[model samples]
Target: MLDSVRLYLRYVVTSVRSQMQYRASFIMLSFGHFLSTGTEFLGVWALFDRFGSVRGWALPEVAVFYGMVNIAFAISEAAARGFDTFEALIKSGEFDRYLLRPRSTALQVAVREFQIMRIGRLCQGVIALVAGSLAVDVAWTPGRVALLMAAIAGGACLFSGLFVLQATMAFWTTESLEIMNTVTYGGVETAQYPLTLYREWFRHFFTFVIPLACISYFPAQAILGRADVLGSPTWFQWLSPLVGVGFLAVALRVWRFGERHYRSTGS
Candidate 1:
């Protein structure tokens, strides 16, 4: 375990140092990432400005939702970038080599690449989180603070599971991965606001199928102590993020099956 940890650290250092060699490129890409996603937030701001609010959910409440999902996605994208590019590894026959390595394939793919530019996304998320915190006026108790952090972590796991699921699909299909973007990227956009505004079926899909709401919405309700919206039970709201871990667990199992299929085919 220590050796694996040390090796992953080496991978991190190597990724950072390589990017440092091209500082100008790194800066430009980071700026581009920040500017692009930041513009999308402006669109959300405009929607609220025009309509005043969606179903009584004011801007501040929406900001909290936005900030939470952003933080989750940023962590996942930054940490699981390699899974984001898993198709490339398969095409280049690199994934096969991974199976022969001492380290776990999942760990190796996770550290296969570190995208330093995701700092821009991380910065944007932090900015929204701070803005939300300032606007919402939640009573910042230690337990609430811990709950918020746990929610963010759970959301990240949910998103990473989506990404891994997307990667796993590549094992069977050689087609474009753009369709999966509908869920991974679309989920980010959808989760950026309260789930109440969405239709009932959409809400159910996110809740039971994808569980995006479980990661942020249901839990946000609990954090805000809101029982009137979806009317989910109080105890369930606090425990909803655990669904994210389940989502990730299922994703890994699918990934393992995909790996086995790939090995059998390669042989």
Candidate 2:
């Protein structure tokens, strides 16, 4: 396992260096990504600007949600770019090369591509988090700080699991991406606001089904010191992030099952 980790890091470094070969293009693309995702938050800001608040939640609180969710997603999208593009590898029969390697196929697929350009979205999330943290009057205790970091890490894992599952689908069929995006990207958009703002069924879907609410909403409530309008206990709030980690573990197990059942495209 330690050796696999080292090899993965080596693969990541090589990928980063290769991408940096065109520094100018990378910088511009990163900026473009920043602008693109930045516009999404702007839309949220516009809603708050006009309505003052949604379900008694102010803009600053929502900003925290926006920030954390985007940060988690950006990390996943960058780290899991290989999984996101796995369908192409399947179509081209490149995945067979991974099967021939001695290392874990999952590790090889993970580092097949690492998107450095996602730093743009990451920067945007940091800005939003800082602005929200400053505007909100929460007494940032050490526990809260730790919770914040845990939430981001857990959320990233959750999103990465989604991407892994997305890739695993390629072993069976290639047409499932659009549906998966509804869970991955759509979850991002939904979790940006307070889950209470949505209908109960939508809230439950994110909470129990995708567990997006576990990594974002429940933890954000604890971080913001707000009561869960849906009445989740405090202990549950603190421990909710582990749900994401668990989800990822399950996704990986599922990936292995898919791998064992995989057949080559025979290209």
Q: What lDDT would each prediction earn against the true structure?
A: 0.87, 0.91
- Give me the candidate number with maximum lDDT: 2
The model with the greatest TM-score is 2
Look at candidate 1 and give me any clashing residue pairs: none
**Model 1, runs deviating above 4 Å:** 1-6
Q: Candidate 1, residues 1-267: lDDT per residue as tens digits?
A: 798889988998999899899999999999999998899889989999999888888887888888889889988998788898899888887777899887778789988888888888888888987887788787787877888888898999999899899998888876888899999999999999889989999999999999999888988886665664778888787788889889998998999899889878872
Candidate 2 local lDDT, 1-267, one digit each (tens): 898889988998999999999999999999999999999999999999999998899999999999999999999998877898899988888888888988777888988889999999999999999899899977799999999999999999999999999889988887757788888898899999889899989888998989999999999999999888789999999999999899889999999888887853443
RMSD of each: 1.5, 1.4
Candidate 1, poorest ten consecutive residues by summed lDDT: 222-231
